[model samples]
Target: MGWHIEGTYFENCNCDSICPCATSGLTAPADYERCQVELAFHVDTGEINGIQVGGLTVCLIGDAPQQMSDGGWKIGVLMDAAASPEQAEALGSVFGGQAGGPMAGLAPLIGEMVGMESHEINYSDDGRRHRIQVGDAVNVDVEDFVSPLDPTELGVRVSGIGFPADTLAAGTGTTATVDVFGMEWDNAGKNSFSAPFAWAA
Candidate 1:
């Protein structure tokens, strides 16, 4: 009944430079006067209800009205197709906020559960860049930004209130797309970042 997970996560949103959601738990108006984003997680090591979830990938695509802190989010979830039925269910529980963990903290913000499904999720990280594809529903490619002060260093470190307290600001090399579960958006050259995250409950 207990669980713990640690991994790397990245997201692309319509917000400019810095997303307000990271700092204010509320997103500022973007191109659509709303916040649309796609988040992907690669689990390096994890377990839930005795189920091993290492090496699995999960994605969330959603949109929020006005401000994220105001809630009213319409979201959908996608799990890796390679996951077994049990693993899928366990993932659903945790992501659905039923199992209680880091995700539980954001459950209240969700206004609608569009759906959940298993898909062919491909995730790759090569030190500098992160790429993800969920069947034909989503595609994202991003890379860490070179520090202005230190070109050799990738990304500028920052602290915020989210799954990962510490994060590296990143930039998208290509446009990201999401077309699934009635949520459609194209976030090209927008805000993005990545961080190592750990959660337990």
Candidate 2:
């Protein structure tokens, strides 16, 4: 039987609407002048080949020219600092496109592999407060959506996600930028976003 891995991930890109890459579009340039994405993954129930796995997070920072599929892509993966060597290896395997799954399908389109780093991922949601951060280079905090009455709040929800609903996102800083061949972009945005597939580890 085919394997199913359930997880959540948040991506920040420099494109407007949905990133072209996700929809198999390679037109002009991506909507945003620059692009930066911080993806955090939590693998709940899954296995790669035969290795049992637990929670793991991967952060990807990349740059692509307007049209996705054009090619050039620089990517870096951040793993949970607490994982063991086996876990780390598994993380790399899954994130690196070696596991032969939905993500691996994109491997051929990716250009730069910035390697993988170990980190500690902490995500929490308290009533109306939500927090997610990766080591230090990336961080996201969301509060009740403004404009709503005192008792309730309404902001923006990513098209279909539930946890990070209608929240504003900010970044600490961008450590690097990449663009080459087909893919190209400079990712940098501190705006509110709501899109499908924001959380899929």
Instruction: Name the top TM-score candidate.
Output: 1
What are the TM-scores, per candidate, against the unseen true structure?
Answer: 0.92, 0.64
RMSD of each: 1.8, 6.3
Measured by lDDT, the strongest candidate is 1
Instruction: Give Cα-based local distance difference scores for all models.
Output: 0.81, 0.50
Candidate 1: misplaced stretches above 4 Å? 27-32
Error of 1 at 49 (Å): 1.0
lDDT of 2 by residue, 33-133 (tens): 53444444566556655555555555555554455566666677767787778877876776777765556756886887866667687754443444456
Q: Residue-wise lDDT of candidate 1 within 104-161, one digit each (tens)?
A: 8889989999998899999998866888999889988877677678966756655656
